[model samples]
Target: MNTTEIFLLAMLLIFTAPYLVWRFCKTDYFAPLVIVQIIGGIVLGPGVLGAAFPDYYQFVFTAPVVQSLNGIAWWGVMLFVMLAGMELDLKKVWQYRRESATTAGFALGVPLLFGCAAAMLLLGYQGWMGVKGKNWQFLLGIGMACAVTALPVLVLLMEKLDILRQPMGQRLLRYASLDDVAIWGVLAIILLDWERMGRQAGFLLAFAVLTPLFRRLMARLGEDDRWYVSLIWLALCGFGADWAGLHFMVGAFLAGVVMDAHWFEQRKLDMLFKHVLLVLMPVFFLSTGLRTKWDAGSYPVFFVAGLLLLASVGGKLAGAHLAGKMLKWKQGEASIIGWLLQTKGLIEIIFANILLDKQIITSDMFTALLLMAAASTMLTVPVVQPRLHRESHAGLMQQASS
Candidate 1:
């Protein structure tokens, strides 16, 4: 009907989905809750329900409402990324430095190389098949999409499964965290290259240099009831990055990492992020879901989607498994690690949406990538949990025998 009513309905659904999942399922199915909410949004939006009730769907998925929701969702993602960065224990990273470095390098490098190649081939095919955009741009977009991993989701899984404390798990987390930093750096460079060229690149260099100086100043701020100053500083980081044409999440993440070196107020900031994530992260996914326009009966699109899903899963598995073997890990452990690292959830969707908005990739490509991400995420828990559990048990028995 009206904008207010539409907003209220979306809000209501967002609040209710988690409750429904918690009541019915007890296995920490929060990701699936998000997936369901997105599907529900699509059904209730202009795709299905809109086909039957055109006026209502038109009003519901209006430009203003979508934009407002997108802004809220982005704020949610910023907090989420901050929390993800805070989850990193720098000491643990150092302790497992060699293994972590090897793993992270292999995990990131292999996927990026493969993704770039796959994008070239796949985008070429898409061009042949008469999809939009120049081949080079579409290929760049595809490469960018495939190269991303959902760092937040991976961290959450490690935390939820109590794996963060294990030796292998610690190594995985360290590498994944570092991999995220590298990916973001690459993304920043790419965005700057595409958007503002030389000026943006120069500003980013200055920001990098100034970030540490700012951190030192923040540290020197008196601890005599001056924590609110830190919040102001964090806000300034967000604002500055936004002004510099960088995503606010980048600023928020850097802020978390810099402050991570100092223990001051880390816990408080983390708790604040947790609260924000629980409420708002789903909204991000719901917005992504609302944008999903899957053609259930289109064989070409469906076939391409399935192929991409296979590539996403297989590519990660091959990369991680080979890396693990090189690091002299047991075969089973290496396989499981590969599978776990394959997860792609909200963060991947966020990146895909960004690329789509930039018109670097078409709607069909975005949908395919989204599907690939969701499928990969769903496969992680099932493939990883049993192996991790078995490893824990074996380690315990080995300790007892000793």
Candidate 2:
């Protein structure tokens, strides 16, 4: 078939396979549709499908077809990241500053340290660090990736758990918001290119100077106008950041960060988020899968993924328990909180993709991170749902007794 036809075929597979697996298998309890799509991407990727059926993989995913898919994937992720930035509820975090800061800090910091140690151990070996990477950059990037929380995915899971509008869910959002900021800041640090330092510095300076002006303009515009102008703004910021060597997604995020949620109707924004996932993000996941490599060997990649999972889950839980103690949270609160916060999801995959793009981590490392991300996300709902049910039951029982 021709390139266009092949691209369409690839698209059909991308959308159909994951939904079928998710719906028919009824994996929603443990793994959501998003998780299943991610797994589907990996399965459909070069490492799995391509490795098994080289001729068919080559026929379907030719150079031109792959490039087209990447174009779609890039825009999809940029919009998704920007939406994530807009979703940050800083107002709520500020309202509960002490608890929010403490929990977010431990939640991010402990995993960082754990992940850094894991990176250190990998440093003594080979096939993990990228060719262009410095030891420090690799360590920090990997550590941050491990520490990172997928705020978008966390929001989805909370909604699924029926706590999205509840006090506890709001609290989790506050924590994730703060961590989101920290994660991106660390990414900028990791992406720092001294040779183009001037460009990056100028980008930040310009962003700082223009952010308020952008906000004022946005506030004055009608919603429809805001929607049109935000897309234009997203394009410009993405371009500027890419030109400055910081990557376009950073700019995409900054574009949305300054824009308040109140600026757009919440229902519309939520719907847009869902639609983006339904339509565009599966392409991103498939492209992400194509980038995966087992050059470091399959067994080793799986082993490292397991290690990262241990660090990620263990550190998140430990951090949550510590925060629970400090905040005097009720019994069992930490477990639920930790489990909720531990999910890495799409943001983690995006983070690893950026690292791979910049060559801070090898493709093997990227694969490991990807596997760890998928597992962490899949683990979230199953672990948290039962605990939340018990808590709800107990709350009802207590009210009856009272």
Candidate 3:
């Protein structure tokens, strides 16, 4: 009932939930631990069990607790971005430059077109229950959502499967990374009002012109013994962006990209990020789950959601697969790559949550997008692993014959 007691209880739950899940479930089910932590937060919050044990739940889910957890999540994302940047191999990208460019372009362009089209049709129908917005903004939002690819999840999967060092994996990772960068640029463009396009254009030109100078400054600062300088710079970037009407996360991401040139030591960055990922990333997803509120919207909304999910999946698969074929990949390998690239995991949900928080999309639309992300991720492993394994075996067999 007391503050200290509530804090203790929350800590107990956080520490024990993994153990409990592991004890009851198979080792393969460990991924669900992240989900459990999130659901636990919701159950213990004001939404469900909190209604019954008001005192205990309220104390546990206090504003301070939520804020603290959110801070951890943000740090986790920062580390994730850093790791992603560290993984960038300019050599590999150069090797597959044409293929990577084509794949990234198709992956992004197809989805953007489909999403915008869907938004136009859906927006005209005011009776559509779950959808949000009724004009160009809605179309832009939908297109943005559809264009997202979960770079963090893709990188983690590639690393886990030991494919990060492979040619195919390298290509996929490069394309995905470029895709993310493109999406961020697109987001910046989308978020800008038409009237402010000139201002945005000027700002972008200025940022571009200053990027080399900024990189040199970061490199110099990085050489200093005081690592806190990076943190200070990060804070200034994030706060400055917030003051300039953009989300802090955008600033954080751009900051990571800028600092990326200096932080090229993968091993050191990996060690730092591993801790952050294991501890703080889960909290971010948990907070996300806690904040999500799903309710029945209009039938049209549900229909549109279903359609949007289909369009998202299909567009990515078709576009990526076509690009792969154009690059002379075998049919099965191309299919596998397409499926792998189709996955939308925590990163996509994080973006959706940002849009939701900004009131750019409705709750129903958020729920639908979340569902799409979960489905895409769940489908990826099953679809790609077997095919890739077979290909690996065949390659080994050919080597033996030679």
Candidate 4:
């Protein structure tokens, strides 16, 4: 088959396989379609499918076809990240400053400390650090990866749990928003290339100067025009960031972060986000899976993944429990909050991909992180549902008594 046909075939598989597994298996209660797609990507990757069927894997995922898929994945993730930035409610965080700060701080900090320790251990042994990775970059990158909260996926899961519009949901968003800012800021620090330092500094300076002008221009435009121009803006920012040696994803986030969410109609913005997830993100998931490697062997990767999961889950829970104590949250609140906050979804995968791209983390380490993220996300709903239900039941009983 020609390269175009092969690429189409690849696309067909990317969309169809995951949906079929998700729908037919009815994994929604435990794992959402997104999770299933992520699993599907890993399964289709070289480590799994390629090992099992080398010739077929090579035939379908030829160099040109893989490159095409990569192009799609890059744009898809950039747009996804941009939307995530746009979703940040800085104003709301400011409104609830004390609680947001306290929670977001613990939520990010504890995991980072734990993850850094894990990275140190991994680096003590062979085969974990990437080829070009320096010690600080690897440690910080891995540390921040543990601290990441997939705000977009958190929104989806909260919506699924029917708490997205609740007071609790809004509270979680505030915490996550603050962490999102920190996550990207830390990423810029880790990605800082001394050789390209001047270029990166220039980019930030230019971004600072242009951001307000961009906002003013956006505000003056009609809604339709704003939407169209935002895309143009996104592309330009992403290009500039990549050129500056900070990844395009950073620029994409910056592009959206400076804009007010109110500029776009909420419903339309939401629908477009959903459409992007449905149409484009699965390909990104697949590409992510393709990048996974078990160079140190599958068993070792799983073992390391288990260790990272322990750190991630334990640190998040500990941090939340501490915050709850300080804030005087009700009994059982911390566990649910912690588990929910521990979710490492698309954003974690994206972080891992960036690390891999920069060679700050090896493929084996990437695979481990991927598994950790998948496990953490899959655990969120199941763990949180029963607690939420019991809380609702108790609330109803108390209301009846009153």
lDDT value for model 2: 0.93
For model 3, the superposed segments whose C-alpha errors exceed 4 Å read: 2-8, 11-19, 27-59, 82-95, 117-134, 193-213, 221-226, 261-264, 296-306, 397-402
Candidate 3: TM-score? 0.82
- Candidate 1 error regions (>4 Å): 25-53, 88-96, 125-137, 222-248, 261-267, 396-402
> lDDT tens digits, residues 211-319, model 2?
8888889999999999998998899899999999999999999998988889889899989999999999999999999988774256999999999999999999999
| Cα lDDT, all candidates | 0.66, 0.93, 0.65, 0.93
What residue pairs clash in candidate 4, if any at all?
none
RMSD of 3: 3.9
Give the TM-score of each candidate.
Answer: 0.84, 0.98, 0.82, 0.99
- Across 1-402, the per-residue lDDT of candidate 1 in tens digits comes to 688888877677666855576457763443555455444444554445656777766666688888888888877776666666666667776787887778877776776666667666675454211233455555555555565667667766777677766776666777777777776676565445354555566656766787788667766776543356545656666666666666676676666665653545657665666677667876786677666664556455556666666666776777788777787777587777777777777667766766665556766666667767776777777778887788879979989999
State the displacement of the C-alpha of residue 245, model 1, in Å, after optimal TM-score superposition. Answer: 4.3
Model 3, 147-195: lDDT tens digits are 7787777776777567877877877888888888877676665455455
Evaluated at residue 241, the lDDT of candidate 4 is: 99
**lDDT tens string, model 4, 323-377?**
9999999998888888889999999999999999999888999999999999999
Which candidate, 3 or 4, would have the higher lDDT against the true structure? Answer: 4
